[model samples]
Target: MNSGEVIDVTRDAIVTFLKVGGPMLVVALLVGVAISLLQALTQIQEQTLVFVPKILALAAAALFAMPFMGDAMASYMTRIAERIAGG
Candidate 1:
C-alpha cells in the first residue's frame, strides 16, 4: 500500500479502537472522579472505595456497549479485509 493508504488504514484502526473503548473509558473516568470527590468530602481514604466503583461502572459500561463495540470492530475488520483483497 501507498503512504496515503497506510495512513487511512492507521486512522481507521485508531478510530475503531476509540469507538470500541471510549464508552468504558469515559465511564471509568467519571466514576473515578466522583469517587475521589466523595472520598475527599468524607475523608474515606480507602483505596477499594475508589477502585470498586470505577471497576463496576466500567464493567457495566463494557457489558452494555459490547454489541455496539463488536459491530464497529467487525465493520472495521471487514473494510480492512476488503481493502486488502481489492489491492
Candidate 2:
C-alpha cells in the first residue's frame, strides 16, 4: 500500500483502539481516583483495596461496552476487507 493509504489505515486502527478501550480505561481511572481518595480519608494504605475495585470497575465497563467494541472492530475489519478487495 502507498504511504497515504497506510497512514489512513493506521489512523483508523488507532481511533478504533481508543474507542474500544476508552470506556474501560476511564472507568478504571475513576475507580482508582475514588479509591485513592477513600484511602486518604481513612488512612488505609492497602494496595489490594485499590486494585479490586479497579478490576471490578474495568470488568463492568468492559461488559457494558462489549457491543460497542464489537461493532467498532467489525466496522474496521470490513473496511480493511474492502480495501483489500479493491486492490
Per-residue CA lDDT of model 2 for 32-69, tens digit only, reads 88999999999998878987778777888888899999
- TM-score list, all predictions: 0.94, 0.95
Each model's C-alpha lDDT?
0.90, 0.91
- Per-residue CA lDDT of candidate 1, range 8-80, in tens? 9999999999999888888988888898999899999998878777777888888899999999999999999
Q: Least accurate stretch of 10 residues (summed lDDT) in model 2?
A: 50-59
Model 2 CA RMSD to the hidden true structure, in angstroms: 0.8
**Overall local distance difference test of candidate 1:** 0.90
